[model samples]
Target: MPLVETAFQVVDAFTDKAFAGNPAAVMILEKFPADDILFKISREFNLSETAFIVPKYEGSTHEFHLRWFTPTAEVPLCGHATLASSHVLFTQMTEKQRQSGPLRFHTLSGELSVEFKTAAPEKLSTRNEMSLPELVMTPDLSIDRNVLCDAFGITENQILFVGSCHWGVLVEIDASTTPLHAIKPNFKAIASVNASAILLATQCGTDLHGEYDFISRMFAPNLGVNEDPVCGSAHSVLAHYYANKLKKSEFKAFQASARGGEIHVVYDAVAGRVRIAGDAVTVSKGVIYM
Candidate 1:
């Protein structure tokens, strides 16, 4: 039998420097392999997420068909991996192919588009902006506040249930008193929640970084990750929350995980979507022989 091989790139999303942001394995294939193989590859990589891409023949926003898989299962949406995939397309594809216009991706969540902006002639880095569907969450009236607080090892006053989306609950913490990084969550207890994951956010204090408006941390034990270094999907939900709170359309956010990264968000009320911009750097590439 002829050996089958595919090329893959590992990118650090939401960061200019390597090893500081969420790392994602991006596989660009002529045709998608079997579902089992995808799962195996994702499990083998053991990253927060892995993305598979194949060219799309037709659709309004159908330049490519994209899918995301975690170690455990496939998810409807993923922000950093999507950003990483966009980085690969914008930087790796032929310059002529990239000059056409905005790149559109057909995803399970919906049709997503990424626009690339030409950088200054002197600048070496390229900038890409992605418009993602704003995920609005509603108050989760079912969860007990006490249990929720216990799960995060915080008091009731320190935590508030902002809302719940398809992925899970959004909880806001008072960073004024407790910094986002100080809280230690009981992953076992957090996993007991009915929701898919828990998003904890806090207002950035002066003691914290000044450039950022807020800092956040994502825990999705349900998805097999203790903490996501940088999560794009969660920020889609966070963007709306902060925009309304601060009455500002644009925001700078930091995910304060061990591997920290920055993300810029702009809310487009006219389109009802949030535009997320970030930097991604390719760390390495290799061929996967199956």
Candidate 2:
């Protein structure tokens, strides 16, 4: 086969600054590529997730087809990558091609929408707001507590709540400071769990000094991403968990990874959705050869 060249860009999601958030590769294709091709490309990029965007003729004028792939497998939903895709459409797409209304993306998860809050001229990034389905979590009684405790390097008592969402397992810890930083997950132990990702969070008090409502970390060793710098999808579950716990619908969160990033979430229990808003910065633009 002849070399097929395609354009791809890297965007740091959930943060306005470059190299500080979870970086995702965005590829705009005229038509859907083969499944194997997407898998290979995602593996080559080696990011936690890569978003593929293609124009959709059906439905609304703003409709587009979107899919997300990790290095290992295709995921059902990815928030940061969806934000990155909208960032490309708002900042990179031609004015004539850009939609005046909200963007409707048809993905495996469902019809998702992204609304641009602010615009910059030919800039590195844009602020886009997206609402994802609220994941209802249930007590994670299936997994062995000993295995989870070993994976997280924490005692069973430190775990306040253990729950499971569609995306992964969520563990709420009691300590907000040193224990959060001291987490050194054993990847092997985590893989023994039932989920693909492990989201660990704690309510922020004096540690964040009211800047953020909570702090979190995401580990997806089974998905080939040991530690996601910033995870938007994970926050969808976190938002619901904290909103009820804190008795508030709006919240600010900080992902305490090495390359930290911020997220704002609003949960609407009646609507069964949560809006996740963040800023993204474009790092590089280039072509991929396959």
Candidate 3:
């Protein structure tokens, strides 16, 4: 008998332009497939991450279960993939599904909601409200200065340790100090100290464009991605930090990866949720023959 195959719609999340956002493979299956199969398909697709969908409570409520894999290992939660998966389901999957209202999804991170809106031609807009677990911020940044310098090929003075949230480390650099292309991080060295993830950011002072408040880059060596095009989880911490720093609840953030992206974030301090809004554009739709 021939091997069974599956098809998926690949979407670039957090970007309105092709090749500018994070690419994720969204597989809409009638029922939940085996874990091995999902892992294999994610490996085959070889994108930063892939999402698997199935009917959860009822036909109306979809369970968007996501498993993020790098070329090496799986991660707990991924923001861009989640956004892309929701976009595929709401915009492209089935006509019977309503496209005007908020869609709910259950994932490892817990119950999440995505609100869809119409943008310009060929562009779909979504605001993903992620229920981030309670964040723990501490002044105790035990990261070795030498390790950070070795990894990014920058001096200790070049790196500014912002704070620690959960298992991730936050750092800030001057926007005009150095360009992203000029600095290269030593993943191995950084990974030795902390294997979770690293966030590097720069202040987009009011002197620059007023559209955005800051620009940033995220690196997760343990998860297999050197740099993520756009990161929503990282923004959760950023939202709190910037909101306190700039004394604003709403701001725009630009991720300056090779595939650049922009995100509008709102900090709900009382609710402990961060709203990340952006545009997603579908680049291709196809099947995988296994």
Per-model TM-score, in order, reads 0.93, 0.93, 0.87
Best by lDDT: 2
How far does residue 155 in candidate 1 sit from its true spot (Å)? 0.8
Better of 1 and 3 by TM-score: 1
Which digits, one per residue and each the tens of the lDDT, describe model 1 over residues 83-119?
8898887876556656778888889999998887543
lDDT of 2 by residue, 113-174 (tens): 99888765565768889989988778877778899789888788778889997789998887
User: Tell me, what's the RMSD of every candidate?
Assistant: 2.5, 2.1, 2.9
Best by TM-score: 2
lDDT ranking, best first? 2, 1, 3
Error of model 2, residue 280, in angstroms = 0.6
Clashes by residue pair, model 3: 151-186
lDDT of 3 by residue, 1-290 (tens): 79767778888888877777888888877777677777788778888788777766456545554555655666666778778877776665444444545666676667677766644444544434444433445554677777777877766776655567554888776545565435677878867856478887766762243467987878887776777778877887788878777898887888877788888888888887878777777888888875
> Which has the higher TM-score value, candidate number 2 or candidate number 3?
2
Query: Candidate 2: what lDDT?
Result: 0.86
Off by over 4 Å in 2: 58-61, 93-99, 121-123, 206-210
Comparing 2 and 3 on lDDT, the stronger one = 2
TM-score of 3: 0.87
lDDT of 2 at 129: 91
